[model samples]
Structures are given as C-alpha cells and as structure tokens.
Target: MPVFFRKIISPSLSPNTESDDVWEAVRAFLKPRSWQRGSAIDEIEHWFKDYYDASAAVSFDSGRSALYAILEAFGIGLGDDVLVQAFTCVAVPNSIRWAGATPVYVDIDKRFNIDPKDLEKKITKQSKAIIVQHTFGIPAAMDAILTIARKHNLIVIEDCAHSLGATYHNRTVGSLGDAAFFSFGRDKVLSSVWGGMAIISQKSPPKADQPMAEKVKSPPAGEAGQKLRQIQEKLPYPSRIWIVQQLFHPIAFAVILPLYNLIIGKVILECLKRLGLLSKPVNDQELRGEKPLFMPRRYPNALARLLMRQLVKLKRYTIKRRRTVAYYQEVFQSRNEIIMPKSIPGGVYLRFPILVQNQEEVMMRAKRAGILLGNWYTSVIDPVQVNRENVGYIAGSCPKAEIYARHIINLPTLISEDEARRVVAMV
Candidate 1:
C-alpha cells in the first residue's frame, strides 16, 4: 500500500534570506528611475566577476539564454555538437539547440556529474564544446574533464546553475572552465526570481548577428509570478498542498507527473497571465522545431537590485546549507538502504540526493510525513516524458544515467533541524 502525505513540509517553501532587507530594496526601487537604466546591473556583473575571478561577467534574463549566448559567441552552430550530461535539466540541451547546435548526451558518475571517461568516448569530429554541469552543487572532476577537453581542443563551458558557491580543489567553479553560466531562478542557491550571469575567462568573441528583440514589453511577468508564489508559500502547508493537488487529476501519481505540468499547469499559468499577473511557470516540455535563436537579453534592473541585496547574505546561506548537509550525513551514514554520494572536497551541498530502491514509495512516505522531498532530474533528460528524439537523447545509450534517474530522491536542506530529524525518522 502507498502512504499518502496530507501535510507538506517543503524546502521549496524555505524563506529567502534577509526578507525585510529585500522588501525594503524592492520598495525603494518602486519608481522606474530606480531600476531602469541604473547602475545595479553593472554592479552585479562586477560582483560576480570579482567573486569568481573571471575576466568578464555578463548578465541575462535566464541561464539558458546565457548559455545560448556563449555558444553563439563561440560560433558553435549547425553541424557542431556540444557534449552534455544526460542526467540534467532540459534547458541544458535546449540551449544547445537554440544555438543551432546538436547536444550529444553523456553519462553521469556517482556524483551526478558528467563522467569524463564516457565524455571522451562521445567526442566526434563535429564536437566543438563540452558543457560540464556541476550537478546539485557537486563539482565535476574538473581535472579529468579539462584534460579531455584540451586533448580534443574543445571549448569547456561550465554549467554553474547548480553550483554558484561551489568550488573544485580550492578554485571557484566558474573560473575553472573557459566560460561558465549561473542561474538565479527561484529554486537555485541564489534566487532573484529569474536571472542569469555568464562569466568569461578567455578573450571575448566578436558580436554575432542580433535578433530583433521580442516586443512583450510589459513588466516581466515571470518576476511578478515569483513574488506571488513566494506569498503563497506563507500559507499553511496543508493549504499549499491542497491548492497544488486541486490542479492535478486525482490519479495524477499513477500517470506521468510532467504530463500534468505540460497540459493542466500550462493552462493555469496562461490564466494567471490574463489576470495581469506575470507568472512564467517552469514548463516540462522538451524544446522542438526551429525557434528564433537570439542574443541574450539584458538582466532586468529590478531583479538585479534584489539579487544585490541577496548577495550580501550569500556566505551565511552557504554556511547554513552546509550545516544542514552535515546533519543529514551524520544521521544517514549507517543506513544500508539509502545510498548517499561521497562528500566532494569544496562542494557546497544543495539538495542532499540519495539513491534508493522504490523511490516513488519513499517520496510518498516522505510527503505523508509532511516532508517535501525534492524530485530533481527524475529522468535522464529530466521530466522524462518529453520527446527524446527532439533533444538527441537515445533512450538506451546511457545505462547508468537511466538507472540513477529511476532511484534518486533528494532531501531538502532548507528545512529546520527538528523537521530534518522527523524526515529521517519517517524515511
């Protein structure tokens, strides 16, 4: 029998740091002059460049856009192949396609990062670059990966979306690769609702042909929606779960969950947009067909302001997250059933992911206990129901990634100690 959760104790519901400070910044910047054409964006880019020791840093509307820009800047398009891990967000591959390049799927190792050995095997004559994702803030084997990239003369682009503060052998992740991109999406280590940064370690490329900017010129709907969702989290857990549960069919769990996100959730988001709320909810569908590949857009002034405020407290947040990971490590060390990855040196723990049999049952049990378990990368290409052919992922090519995708579940690091204990007990 499956255990069903009545209450939700979600890490996704964790409060942002220095909320009062952030709100104050938001209030002060209410006027158009405050955000529009201000120095905040420049300040943020410099901050990231200095923090990561990069030669330059550029901000964008989203991480995917940042990556697309990198590929475009490097002239990696049509007939070029970019190597990427199979166990990752669809956005990773989508960025490649957006740049008119093909994404070659590679397998992941135990740390949920690209396997250098497998990476070397997939490099064909058309391979132009490698996007090494530091999965879940766990750094990949940079030494091995860099070696492989150097051997093949491929440009290395680090996907630092999951690893803002993470380091590899005393070096920050963004600085290790030739170029790297970081996301400031709602659930990332640092959240500004929706923003991204691209850092360059080498010489900049000549500007590419720019696409005419799309004219959806109202205030960013995605930012407004993120604020509304943050307010929604303040509601009691039961109420939150009830509201989400209402959107899905009663038999949702039995069917593929991403399907619900694609069909029903898309409608709800459109309704929210019509209501004058700019809610750009995350979609689970794979990128297909030819789309206009445009140069990365500038970061919004408002989001840059919010991100600046959050940056002040980033060190504290990193410390707290590491402490939470330590707690989980101590508690779960002896458990035979739960398989936690070995600790990576200089790694900043994001969600504490573990491999287990009967992952669905475990997640259900956790939810019933009011624990909000993370369901990250539940498939090799993530949100697995998407058309594999569209993204160039062969279903049976990466056997290990397929297996890990089936068994991996993540414990939230944003919960309280007591809640963490309860989660451990329940699981």
Candidate 2:
C-alpha cells in the first residue's frame, strides 16, 4: 500500500505558511474590493527597494518576467548573449530567450555556482551580461564573477530566486550584481503563491533605513527611472480571475495538507488541478521554451499584500534556513556516502544539496517514508522534462551540472532538527 503523506518539504508548497496567511487569502478571495486593485503594489516595491539596497524595484508577474524586463531595460536582444550557468531553472533561460538574447551556458563549482573559469572561457564579444544565480540560496563566487564581468564590461544580473534574505561577504545577493530579480513563488524563499520583482542597482540606493515616503514616491532619476517606468507601462495588469485562482492555493492546501495521503488528498488535489484552480509552478509551454500566454504582466496588488505578510517574517525564516543547513552539515560531516557542499559564510542555504548514488532510490524511499525530499534541477535545465535543444542546453556541455542532476537531492531547511534527523536517516 502507498504510504500516507505526512509532510512535504518541497519549496513548491507552503509548508511554512501560517494560519493567518491562509485566512488572509480567504479574505482576499471573498472580498474582491480588497484585491481587485490597491496600493499594495507600491508598498511592496518600496519594501524590495529597501531590502535589495536597490535604486528601483519593479514588480512583475513572475521572476522570469522581472528578468525579461531587466534584459529589455538594458536593450539586450538579437545577437546579444547573456552568460548563465547550467543546472538552473528553465525560467532563467526562458527569460533570456524572451528578450531575444542567447543564454551561453557555464559550469558550476563545488558551491553549486557558476565557475568563474568556465565563465571567462565562454565569453565572447556578444556577451552583454552575466546572470549569476545564487543557486539554492548559496551565493555564487561574486568576487570572481564581478571581476570577470568588469574585465569584459558586462552587466551582472543576479538571479536571486532562491537566495532572498541570503547574503555574501556581508552584502545581500541582489545588491552584489548590476541588477537582480526575485521570485515570491510558492517554492521560493517567500510565497505569495505567484509573484516576482526586479531590482536595478545601477546607482546607490537610498540609505539602509530610508523612510518609506522617500523610497516609494521617489524613483531613481535619469536612465534607470525611465527604464523602470517603461517596463511598468508595458506590463499588463494581472487578470482578476487568475488572481483569485492563485489565492485559492493557500485555501485549498489549508484543508488538503492535513488530509493529503496517497489516496484522498492526492485525488482532490488532482481534481482541483484538472479544474484549473491550482496553477502549476511551471507551465508546460515553459518546458518547451515557449512563453506562457498570460505572462509579461505586472504582479497583482492582492498578491503583494500576501508577500508583505511574508516579508514580516523574513528574518525568522533566514535563521531557520541557515540553521537547518548547519544541522545537515554537522550530521553529514562523518558520513562517507554523500558529498556535502562546501561551507561558506553568509549563504542562506535554501536547500542543503548532497550528491549520492542511486538518487532515484533515495527519493523513492523518502517518499514512502512520508518525507518529500526535493529534487531541484533534476535535469541540466530543470524538471527533467524540458526540451534541451529548445532551451539551448547542448548535451555534454556542462558535465558537472549533468552529474549533479543525476545524484543531487536537496534536504529541506524549514524543518526542525529533530524532523531533520528523520530526513537525514532516510539518506
């Protein structure tokens, strides 16, 4: 018999969601006036501007949309090549493609970040920028990457989808690069079910403790300000129906999470999905490198309200994530079968990545044990379902990413050490 689903650790669901957040979503769905339109958009923008130490923070429908806007803002297109590492989400590459720029693949190092050496090797005259992903909340080697980027006069766009509240060398991940984008997707560091933002750091942002009145009302001057306004104007406002559908996520899971076994909960979840209520984190068109029809829109105000609630708990979440990684490191220190990532200061450690033999078997066992061991970057691109050629990922290009994909299983960080021990023993 299939095992009962006791818990899920994957970033996709809101295991970290509080009861209040679900209740808030319920309120928003029922009260259209609360979510139909509001000032939450500007408030969230100010919050990101403050958080990322950026001159401007622009909201978008998804992280990819933010990235796309950043690319567009910089006028990267056609023959331009944006250097990006392998073993990342398809959304990263999709954004580049959406802007008509090619994503030149680079390999990752022991830290699961872009190898500066390979990054330099792949650079060409067409290389306009380097998209450095803080892979799984672990900061990439920004010192080396920035040096390389400067040497070539390339813009550095930090992909902070997994690295919110994560830091490197005392600087936040998003602030390290020329620009950065964040995901508030169900699976990201924070969850509003579906949201994202872009932070352009061309100029020094307002002071760390800048007043909100000064921050939101005052956008950066000159080119940066113009770019942000341009992107915002081009974006379509999110559909009200879509907004409610995403809001339904937390509500559905509030009940579903408690009853989700291999039987009943699974059936209800599938039924709701078939009914087009719960949106998949990744769309099918994205796997094939095609843009979703509903994309390139501005993030909704209602969802921003949800994100605001999460922002209030950012510090608490960061501590838990880092502590969980430390716990994993301590346990794996004596183990010989699994290879732990190198320890680095300031890394938030979104998911503790480990390489092991028989990755499939390990995950299968974890599933049966009622522990949902996350499989991030299951393929060089992600989800193991993407069309490699369509996504521009050539076979045998990044061998490390491929090997890591075969063996990597990410342990959850939001869990307690006692629960982590249960997860660790399964490995």
Candidate 3:
C-alpha cells in the first residue's frame, strides 16, 4: 500500500460566526457612500493599534509599500544607507531602493535575524536606519539591536512581515521598534489576500506631512479567484510527488518539472486569467521600480473587512502554529543531523526551519514521500535562481547567510502534531 501525506500547510478558509458577521457588516457598509472617514480602514488601524499597543497605524496596498512609506515618512532617502539582514526576502532591499536609499547587508546569527555585532560594525555616518527582520517569525535580539541603534542614533524599523503575533521578551514584535510593518500576503499569519500595515511608535521620528493618495476601487474579483486557484494548485501534492517519483532520473525530474510548470501550468493559468477565472500573478517588475516618492493608494475596504474577520481568530491560529513548532522541537531534539535555531524568550514559530546536510536531496526525498516542505530563502536573498549581483549582493559577502540559505528547509506550521512527527520520521 502506498502512503499519502497530508498538505503541509493550508490557508484557514473555514467560515464561522465572525465571518458571517463580517459579511453582514460588509453588506451594510456597501451602501452608497457608507464608507466615510471612520470605516473599514480606520477599524483595521484601530485593531492593529490596540492589538500591538501602537500609538499610530497606517495601511498600505502591500507590505513592501508599508516599508517604503515608513522609510519615506522618516526622510530616509537619497544618500542614506539602511542596514538589512542578508538572508531576507528580496522585497526588503527593493523597498530600500524604492526609497532612494542604499541597502547595506548585515549577516545573521544563529537565530537567523540580523547579527547585532555585525550590525554595529556595518554602521557608518551614512547609515540612517536598520530594518530588523524577524526571519520566519523568530524574534531578533531586540535588546542588543536597540542598544546599538540608540548609541548610533539609527532608526529601528522592525520587519514583522513574518513575525505578526510574535513577541520579543514578552513584548509584541511591532511595539518594540521605532516603527514596524506587517504583511498580509497569501502566506502571512494574518493574510487579507494582499495588504500591509505600518505601526508608528510614540518615540518614532516625525513623519512626512504629505497625505497619502485617496482610496481607489476594490481589488478585482479575479484576484480572489487567483488566490483560490493558487490554493487549489497546492492541493494535489501527492499526485505531483508521484509523477516526479515516476521520472526516476534526477536530471529528468529537474528538467521536466520546470518545463511542466512553465509550459503547462503557465498556459492553464493564463487561460484561466483570460477567462476571468483568475488574475495574473504580479511579476517582480510590476512590484519593483516605483519612484522613491511614489505613494500607493489606501487599502481596500472589502479586504480590510475580510482581515478583520481573520483577526477574530488570530489567537487560535497562532496557538496551532506554536503547537506544531513544539512537536518539531520534540522530534528533532536528539537528531544531530538537523539543527534548529535557539529558542527566543517569546518568539512565535511561523515556520519550523531546520538546517541539514544535502538539503536538496532531503527536500527531494520529502517531496517524493508526498510531503510539502517550505523552501524559504533558498538564496541569500529569495528567488534564488536570480543573479545575486543584479540585486547588489556580492558573493561571499555574508558567508553565514549563504551557508544557511543552502542548508535551510522549513516544516509547515499549519499541520497537526501527528502530521509533523510523520514528516520527521520520513526525513
């Protein structure tokens, strides 16, 4: 008999009382000109402020936009340098460049966050800010980071893109920084399809006085359909794995998967897009290259309402993720082949990342067993296949980050403890 593995992660799509209430709220709010000043966006801002204990909150079209806005709000542009972790998503560097500031890469520590020692060493007179990313929701050493930033008078902006609901030393991740940003993209802890929030602390520097652009129309219906399709695509992992296993040869598996993904998957998705069954995914060019002064329109009302519903059950979701992390911890504790990051005081585990030798082979075996593992930050900066030099990254500049990039693979936080253990046993 063949074994079938369950999905590693699945978006929370089940509806409840709160979801029903949200739909009713949206329906009532949809009346002609019902959404005025104190509406969905304001409600979300208030929710974030109360939840994170933040003084001020702002929403944006995307998390990258939130970071850009924060950088611009503090006037960190043109000739300024912002230090970021070398092992973060490419969007971090892109946001810095979008603000007309240079991004200086800093190496990561055992916790996979920016190394405070390395961060201090990289500071120059040109260094205006530090974007401390909590990689995979593992909180960085805030005490050390803050000490260095205070001594150097550098702005501290926490990239809570992966760290929503995460904490550092009993304090929420967003509240500890001068300013912070959260992403609500597809895979985020509190996804609203595609949205972001910025929390401005009381001690944050004076923000720009310019008002943001007016609200635009809601996101296209096709966008929701596209997200649905994306979820559907991940559902057939067993079949995908079986197909790959049948190929036998590594070269054939490598060549065929890409070709199938590029040619067959692309054509089907494009057809769906043309039929209005799905929307075309946003490409890198579309996301990047906005002017330094460019300000995106406000978050949509419908999405804000959707996000508010998710917030109602955020605690439950976080608890489940924590349980999964603990399961992985227990299983991998005695295994010398796998290395887990040191536990932070109050960190939330977004994805249970582990370092192993022969990561490619491990991942291939996991896939062949119908396991869906997370291949996050496979490169120093993500989209690993892209040339590092093109993104201003120099090879060997951050050796530790490069090594981690090569060895890291993440376990799903959305599965049950039993499922997690099964994944470990298979590995």
Candidate 4:
C-alpha cells in the first residue's frame, strides 16, 4: 500500500476565477456603506432558502453559536433538561448549557446518531428540548425522532452542522426539527470561512425562548463584506492551486498546523494583540452559552471570497459524495466485522462513518496504510463533565455509538470514483 492517503476529489467551484467577479460585486456594494452592510450575510441566508429551500436563516459567528441561539430561542434554560446524543461533538451539549439548561446524555444507535428509543427513555418533566444531530452527514431516524417529539410536545433542534445538503425522506434535515443550526467552516459542506447559520422553524419560532435583546442584535455584516469584494477583483488568478496543495500535501499539513497552533497558544501575546476574548476561546460557563473550547479559525478573507464564488459547486460535490457512499455500502455489505451506514434516499454524504470492533487496532492499520481516519467524537465531554457528574457518559450505555466511536473509521467519500475504490481496499 502507498504511504500517502488518497486525495479527496474536490467538488468545489469551477473556473476558480469566478471568485474574483463575485468579490468585485461584493466590494462595490460595501464601499458606500463603510463595510456596515448585511448584504453578504443576506446572500448566505438567501442561499439556504433559494438553494436548500429552507424557511428562514439567521447567520452567526460559528456553528456552536447557532446551536446556542436555537436553545435560547426555545426558552430552554435554568434547571430545564435537553436530551443530547452522547456520541456527538462537545458543541452539542455545550449549546444546551449555553441556554442555562442541563444536558441529559442519551445513547446512540448504529448510525452514530441519537437512538430514538433511547431518546424516549431519557425524557422527563424537566425535559424541554431534544438536540438531534445528523452524525457524519448520516441522517438519524428523523421519523422516529419527530414522532417522539410530537408525542411529548418537546422542542426539536436539529444540528444540521454536519448535514447541510443532506435530507431525510425528501425533507431537508434542518426543516425536520423545530429549528436547526449549520456550520460553514473550512471543512464543512459549505465554506464561508468561519460562519454558521440558524434555520428557524417553518412554523412560528418560540418567541419566549429567543435570546434577550441584551444579547441579540441585527447581527453585524462585519468586515467580511468589504473583503469579499476585494477578493473578487483578484479571482481571475490561480488561487485554487493552494487549496489543491493543502489537500494533497500531507507532510506540509502535518508541519504547518502544529506551527500555527504553537503561535496561537501564547495567551499573553494574543491578548496584547487585542485578540477579542470571544475570538480566543469557547466560553464554557454559559449553560446555553459557549463551552468546550474548540472553534475553527476563520478562513482568510481571500478564501471567504473564493468560497462565495464556489458555493454553487456544492451541488456537484453532493452528487459525488452520494455516489461514493453507495459504492462503499455495496462493497462493505459482506463484511461482518463492520456495520455500514444506511442510505437516506436523496441525502448527500458529508462523511462516511462506519462501525467496527477494535477501533484502535483498525486505526493503527489504516494509519500505516497512509489513511488518515477521523474520530468524530472521542469522548462525551459535556453536560456531565460540567455538571460534575463524575460517572460521565459511559461507553456501554450507547453500545452502537461506542462501537462506532471506538471501532469505526471514517473513510473519505468525496473522492473520485477510482479513489473511492482504493479507500475501500484499504478498509
């Protein structure tokens, strides 16, 4: 086997030159407004409704922020309990806490998403909401979750941060819940540097639950507007080459990321630099506020402009991801040692996460083969950790999630057909 991980087939924008034109338009609009306009923000919001057919979208600084906003919007706080998947990223429970609510860790099924059965068991009078996450772009049992939510009249907050273009039974993931949150980070389905969005419910959003005016604002258009235009004017150049290099250069990445973190680790220097506290670390004290400090850094202004231009290409990427996932399912079906993800009719595969046994051993093997596998959530770090529940969200509780978390290895599905086959062989 080669000592290099197979490269992902990029489904990003074409002409890579259009980013220039898009940025030019952005620049022209922001000059008179002194970068105070929200049109760029509106473009992102409209994309949800126009492209994904979402009801309404509110842009935020990050996916985590959107998650917190949704919880606050639902009036989930102080002694209230929100059921969350123990297998999801820390951001899930952290959002629950941000709302001044406690998060009850629930087990997950083989799909790596919250188990509907487990969800039903965890509900109580204090329960005010359920945070449904579509783990690894794989849609959870939305029908079952919706049924349970309806029976209990519980608020549903779909974490579409990982399932952007993904749908469950023809309906978009965000629309399935009472409200939804999406991530538009560098690694997400859609890239907008470091921004995120909150998709409000199709019905009425719970006004009593929304953030207080003290914390809410019209949401500034920010500096992104001005920079977007400047980048557009320079788009005709070959900028994607850098993108390709990063995706393909394993050695450079290993060296570069560590160096970047080292420079950022200096608290004194960062503070002196006037790095805003909000920009420094995630605030974990808020129970519906920020917790578990890990936020993706904002992409360079140039990159954001590039992403804006390339947003349309997401459709093609979605198709390739879906097809690649199908191929893996077919080939891996006969392997009893692994549990493959189920098909979600028309959804795109943001990532292809599979369950297995002896994950450490599997990971070691894959690593030796130059396959860089991702451990979506290594531990359930929230609600319990913060609540001082020393018992923590144990492994055996959600056997399926634990199995996937431990033994499951995520293979790249956003690769060319040939690359997909090679990855399967490595598995």
Candidate 5:
C-alpha cells in the first residue's frame, strides 16, 4: 500500500513494483466492490475490539462525528464544559461545542500534552469531561492525568487522532480512558482518507445499570450500544459525489506533484480545488468553528476497505517510525539551537517535532532548499488557518501553548530512511 501511495503521488519515483500489486490496488482504488455498508465495517469493529481489548467499537464518518456520538452517549451537554489542551486541532473543541458544551482551553507542558496543573485549575462544577489528546502519538502523562480525573470525577476521552497502537505505561491508550476516539483521516496515524471509530473501555465498565456495548456478530445489547446504533441509523451514507471527490485525491496528486516544479502542477491543483474535485483536510467553515453539512455522517464501507489494507502494514510502519526517531535523536543530541522532544519506548513519533529559535526562517530555508516540511499547529489552533476568537481561545490563556506554536517545527517520520536522512541534512 505504501508503494502504491508513492507511485500515485508521483511517477518520478523509481518504478520498483517488487512488493506491490500496483494494478490490483489501482483497480480496488478506482472501483471498490462495495460502496454500501457491508461486513467490512463489522470486521473493522471486531478488529478494534480485539486489538484494544475493548467491549464495543462504533464507526463514524469522521473522528469529530465519533466524538460527538461519545459525548451524546455520556449525556454531556448544555451546561457542561470539556477541558482540552490548546496546542491541538480545531476539531477537538468543535466536537465539544457541537455537543452543546463549552471547551475550556488549558496550557500544555514541555511534552506538548496538557499540563495537569492547568487541567486541575480549569475544573469547575460544570466541567464534565477532560479530552486528553496524545499529541504526535506521544503518550501524555497518563498516570498524572488519570489521578486528576478521578479526583474531579471527570471522564477522560483519549483523542487518539495521532495515536493508534500507542501505549501509556504498558497499556494501549484507547483502552486506558473511559472512552476514546481514533481518526483515520488522510494524514493521521492511519489513513482511510476519511474515517474514525469510538471505542468504549471494558477494563472499567460502568455500573450494571449503565450502558454496555457488547454484541459480537449482531447489534450491541445495552443502553450504550442501542444509543450509538440509533445514532448511526439516523445518519446517511456519504453521498456518492463526495465519495468520488475523495477518490479523485490520489489521481489528482499523481499528476500534480511530479509537475509541481515546472509550474503546471500548481495550476492544475488550484483548478481542481476550485472545481470541487479535491477537498482540503479542513474546509473554510471548519476554521470558523462551524460544522460542514456534509459531515457527522456514517462511515462508508469503501473507506473501511482502505483502512483494512493499512492495518496490514501497521507493524512495519511502527517499527520504521521508531527507527527513524532513534536516528533523529542520535544526530540531534549535539545540537544546541533546537530543543528536541522527549523520546520514549512506547511513543510513536507520527511526525517528530523540535523547538527552533525562528520557525518562519527555518521553514523558508527548507522551502528554498526544495524540501517541504510539516507545519502542524503553526498557531495554537493549527495550520495558521484557524480564527482563535471564533473557537473561544483567548490569546494569553495558554502561554506555553502559544510559545510552542511559534517555535516548533516537525520532521516527517513516515518516509523512507533515505528520505529521512535527506530531510535531516537539509534541516
């Protein structure tokens, strides 16, 4: 699948088709056998249940939708608040708002996850839950965060957007919280182009009277199971048109990236965006804190198949990412101009980040050298595309987050070893 993705990105890449069935993958990509809900969805759910040792796993159109479902299932709404860190995606807070709850922004620690001190300080009578985001797949200080959650009686929802197969103290992240959500967006830890799943923890299930989502081959049985099932029933499948738009992404990219330097690719990409044949990861409305009409829908089976294929390579991807991270740490230890992030045995460096003195100049230099570096959370709300006030983020509310946003630059961990060294040399 990785080989196929590279080939689809640009034909200029070596024609090494040794391990990949390029034509088979192409046929599967262009024409999936099942466009409607099928056994694939159940198969994925079962896979997650086994992988995380969870009771139930429900699929959704996107991570936000899965989060929304979890919020509604937990009955967190109206007069409630959800505590989340500032150095994160807009979707986290957006999901909180959509649940009729307020998102209270908290400062972050050096590790980039929420600081337990600020988290405890942010708690109020109305604070119902705490969304602990595992930034860049680095496990947050789970022991400390869980201690605070228990003291405040707050539910912890692990935002596993950047963390699939990530662990906290020898336990998997998704299984450590009350409930957790995973994103399978194009650039997330796993890519299905557009997909997500909500898993309810079985380790510490709620009281007997509470909802229990435990159904093997059939619909889940208890209140939680029935509630989520009902939510899915009310939702509709992604429109065929939108599905085609997703399908166009790779085909469009394959033609564009190779020709990018010649200037033709730039025009083609912009034209495709204007023609609505390509979709941005986040649309204009999302940055403004408004949900798109197209979203909050059910996960499509076609995308589920894509996700299943990615599942096959999960082990290899994790191994390569860790190896790359080790190499980065080894080379960067002697450097003084930059501050490297902490390296741990279980953390997955989705994109390795380091704090630099001048982020803008570093990015400019990389661009000049013909290297494209990752720029996530360029601002507290991310991509420099979000409007902070619209998302209810006060400028000075989280000082540490703001500082990280300004100085942090990321190195890609999801590329070839050759590519990794090349990027390191350029930086």
Candidate 6:
C-alpha cells in the first residue's frame, strides 16, 4: 500500500543478509581507531577489488561524488564536453556539469545506451569524455563504446548505477570501462542504501599525479554524519530496512534537506566544511550549479551500509529477475507494437523493457492491475536543434527504446514467478 510506482523500489527488500564472514569483518571494523587504521575502508576496497576485479576501488560519500571525483582525477574540466545520453537520471548531466565541464546530449541505441554510430559523429576537438550508462540494469554496448573511445582518445566513464552484477560479453559492466561508478541506492541492483563505489580500470589510475583516495579522518569532524555512519557500521543487513528506506527519502528531500538549505547549508551539505547529518556533496562548485542535491543523507547511508552486507545474495536475486523477464519475453515476443529485449548469456535482466503502441494507455491499465512501469529513458540527449530536426528520427531512432519508453511497463521482476505471470496477463 505504499504508493506503488509513485514509491521508488527499495533495494533493501531483496533477500540480502550479512554472512558470518562479513559479520566478522564488521566486528573488526568497529574496533577503536578503526577509521585511522583504514581497516574499514580497506575492507570495502578489497570487496570491490574482488567482486569487480578492478585494480583499485574508492568509496565516496555517495555515487554522484564518485562520478565527479573520477572526472576531476582525469583532468576533465571547463571547455571540455562529455557526450551523455539525454534520457538518464539528472545525475548524469549533473556529474558532467559538476566537474567544471558541459554535457553534450546524444541519442541512444535501442538498448538504452549510447548509440555507437551517434557517438562517433559527436566527437570533436573539445570532446573529452564519453559517459556510457547501463540504463535500467541493461548493459550498454561496451564493445562499440570502447572502440569509439579508443579512436578518439576520449576518457570513458561507465555509469553502472543500474547494473551492478550485470555483464556484457562475459565481462562485468564495472570492469569494462576506463573508470566506472556503482550506486548502492534504494532502487539499484545492489543496495548499499545510499553509498557508491568507483572502480579504476586495471590498466591504470585516473592520472599519474593524484593518489587514489584521501584517507577519511576519524572522529569525523561532522558529528551527525559520523554518528549515522557508526550506526550503519554496526547494524546487520535486513529486508525490513526497505520499509524505512522507502518511507524516508521523500521526507528527507521535503523536510530535512530544506532545513540544511536555510542555514550553514552550503558548508554542511555541499562543502562538508562541517558535516551536519548529511552526506557530502561533490564540491563547493556543485552548490553553485543549477541542479539539485546529488548526495545521500542520514537514512540512506545507514540503510545502504547495511545493504552492502546483503550483496552476498546478489546471484540469487539476479536469477529471480531473469526468470521473471524470461516469462514476459515469451508473452510479448511476437507482439508487433512491443519489443521485449533478449537477455544475452552474460547479461542479467535489471528491468525487462517492452515496447508498445499506446504507452500512456498501457501504463494506465498496468497501474490499475497493480503493475508498475518505467520510461527506461524519456528521450535521447541530442541537442535542441538536432532534437527538433530529428524529431522524426527520434521517433524511430531507438524504436525499441522509444517503444519500450512509450509503452514499456516495468513490472516488479522483484516478486515471484506467479506475479510475473499475472503481470503479463494484465498487460
């Protein structure tokens, strides 16, 4: 009875719990001076290294910060343009802008990632980075994106915010790019509740000069955030945590954040000059930008940290989602107006996107039946002029993406197979 689609999916609901191995690790982390010794950070870093097979992993206050941090490390800044898919969450463009750079929107392929052909055409002298996003848990076309990045000498930043355990061509999404970010937020495949991890490719670090990550000092001057982190570090992962996580976000945005916005807001929220109860925003410059907040707050962090401990169950969750997607694919495969994306052998289903003729009507009907859907992406990020002239092209450009976006209803692949069958019947 929480608001269905209006309510964001809480990743905590998945059956992830801390194992004895992880519990022992956390016990060690909670010892005195744990912060200074870097034991806790090291545990997380090593987890990332082992899980993602990356050379180095760094944790930031949140995922968006990780994105901007990597951008800064790579020397991307003002006068540089990063091509991004227009249909992504606001965070994608905000990440580019936060790094003292601009975002040049591009169209996507039918799969909801950067269209390789379009990406090749967008390259210019000022172009510096290409952010390839795995939208809604579907892996982007990494092979093509990598080929283009290599030809242009552009830095590739893979936004694995959606697809954490997903793979492309037998390689994990996080390991395929030069650098990548993973969000362990409420609705993600992995729920750290509110945290993010950035992995530097095994080939090299962001640049020669900067150290991977600065050591986070203990007794963290920010009393509120530190307390929250402490509590999170102690709690065991729980499915019920999703209830609290789902209830808190809109409240935080509406009530708590506003209070921060009024006084000492800049320092506490953005600069972390003195962390109040919130997570650190990217930089002082981020506060000055035209976007909204991009970091986690008290509740998300507590739940997220607890959720990270739940990741031992990822393989199980991925399997369930795949089974659900498989059923939907069978039902909709022959429907002319709709498109059901095929799951590649290595790829797992994040959300099964389907194209339909009357998206609006399908959404209404699906909602009436307790089914929820998404616009995997709304539109490709092509520039305004191109968007207008290509309006017709946009119409057919990502036929599958557009069809999926327009009529594609994302049912809860999170539930049982019976629920998936019911969803198909109702749709």
lDDT of 5: 0.76
lDDT per residue, candidate 5, 1-427, as tens digits?
2321221211112111112323323544566456656777889889998998876788998899999988887777898889999999898898888889999999998789999999999988788788999888899988998888767667788999888988877989888877899988877776766889988776442222323342111122245555666777798999877766665555556566656645576689789878877767788898999978877899887767667777877787778778988999999999998798777668877778899999998887765544556777779987588888988899999999998998998877866777677667877
Model 1: colliding residue pairs: 5-368, 221-278
Worst 10 residues of 6 by lDDT: 215-224
lDDT scores of the candidates, listed in order: 0.69, 0.83, 0.67, 0.59, 0.76, 0.57
Per residue, candidate 6 scores C-alpha lDDT tens digits across 345-372 of 6555666666667777877776565444
Task: Kindly report which residue pairs in candidate 3 clash with one another.
Answer: none
By lDDT, is 2 or 3 better?
2
The weakest ten consecutive residues by lDDT in model 5 span 9-18
Give one digit per residue, the lDDT tens place, for model 3 in 1-427. 2433132222222111233543544453454243222377779988987887765677775687778777766667888889998998777788888778998999999999999989999989788889999988999999999888777767788999888888787888888867889987656776555578877776544223323331111122233223322322332121222212211122222222233323553365355446554321234453443343323435655556656777876788788888878877887889999999976656667777899998999888876665657777788877665455656777888889999999998877766677667687777
TM-score-wise, the better of 1 and 2 is 2
Query: What TM-score would you give candidate 4 relative to the actual structure?
Result: 0.70
RMSD of 5: 5.6
Candidates, ranked, TM-score: 2, 5, 1, 3, 4, 6
Candidate 3: stretches off by over 4 Å: 1-38, 204-282, 286-295
lDDT by residue for model 4 (282-307), tens: 24453233444433222223333334
Model 2 residue 242 CA deviation in Å: 0.5
Every model's Cα RMSD, please? 11.1, 5.8, 11.7, 9.9, 5.6, 11.6
Q: Quickly count the clashes in candidate 6.
A: 8
Clash counts per candidate, in order, are 2, 1, 0, 20, 0, 8
Off by over 4 Å in 2: 1-5, 34-36, 202-222
* Candidate 5 wrong stretches, greater than 4 Å: 1-33, 204-222
TM-scores for candidates 1 onward, in order: 0.79, 0.93, 0.77, 0.70, 0.89, 0.68
